[model samples]
Target: MSLPDFSGTTPQERLASLRRSVAGRIVFTTSFGLEDQAITHMIREGGHDIEIVTLDTGRLYSETHAVWAETEQRYGLRIRSFHPDPQALAALLDDWGANGFYHTKDARLACCGVRKVEPLKRALAGAEAWVTGLRADQSQARGDVMAIEFDTGRGLAKAAPLHDWSREDVARFCETNGVPVNALHAQGYPSIGCEPCTRAVKPGEPERAGRWWWEQDDAKECGLHVDADGKFVRAKEAVQ
Candidate 1:
């Protein structure tokens, strides 16, 4: 991959350029979270030709699944669904016995690797660039999320248009545009992920407090975005 000179520009401008370059081959991955919803609206409004996809981690909330159906009907775009390898899942289950994630951090990460990361790797295999709803305000690790990035960590070119958007900005966009959202957000589930691993956050809490609440401070991410050495850096390294 040639590292082209991308003068640091605003997210909107970067998105416009990406659209012009990739045309209809770009893909967006959404989980129907607030940030994801905002991204979907922006790409649509900007008139970018990109396909949207999502991974049904097999343990997602019912509300998330329901919104998927509603979103497709509302947007009139098909969101291709990706699933984990059934044989791989069966093997993991047999070795770890299910619910092993609750036992240790390593165990939990292993489950997430099989359920989310592996499936995502397959989903992005043929794509030139992928868009995500990740926001810089969501976590310190993501504080440097740029509009365009080479995701050497995941072996894909990644673009995060809403990386600089705040939580309030995302909410306003969804409210103003009538974008369908997960019902649990209104119930105080600010950060939504797998059902078992996520819970409703208390009032006046950090947005991501609900995700991996049982783990220590720095162990929030699910290994899907981490480097080979188990470090979570802000920018993606060179994809040799």
Candidate 2:
């Protein structure tokens, strides 16, 4: 499917055009964060036909759940949820304790694979295009992200409506439009993922510093996004 040239259009215009072009083949994944909330508002309030989904890692914060419910109520939309395969999750837990991810990078990635990446693959299976709330300023890994690009990892066209929006811009939009957002964001958690792996960022730290704080490396992504090498690599043996 050929996408319309979104070069000179606003984000809302681009999103509307993408929805019309892709129709039912488009899906949006949200983590209920501030940015995602803004995009959700745009999609829902704009009456776009795009389907919205989320990963339920079972390790999410209560605040995240609260926002999810609130979003549904506010927009009167049902956000589909995807979860890890039970057998795989049980096998992973049996091999490594519940918190095994704290031990090594491989273990952490394995957990992420079962709880996030794998489920995401299923969620995106029939999608021709997927939408994200990613912004270039969020992390070094995403510094080069464009508004629209083909996601080689998922083999689909990925759209980031908020790609150029700033943190302050997102905050102002949410406040001005009354968008539902995670409560954790107010308590210093600029980025919220699974509850155990994420924490609040300290002063002088990057917004994404709160996610996977133990890792000394700067590649803090959970394999949902492409890596610096432009590969969708994840922990070995995660699929089996």
TM-score of each: 0.90, 0.92
Off by over 4 Å in 1: 3-13, 236-240
Best by TM-score: 2
Tell me the tens digit of each residue's lDDT in model 2 across 56-114. 99999999999999999999988999999999999989988899999998889889989
Query: Residue 19, candidate 2: how far off, in angstroms?
Result: 1.2
Candidate 1 lDDT over residue span 1-240, tens digit each: 643233335555666777776633578888889888777777777777777889888999999999888888888888898897999899888878778787788888888888888988888877778878877788777677766678776555677777777899889888999999999999989988899899998887788889988887654887766777776655644211
Question: For each candidate, C-alpha RMSD in Å?
Answer: 2.9, 5.2
Worst window of 10 by summed lDDT in candidate 2: 231-240
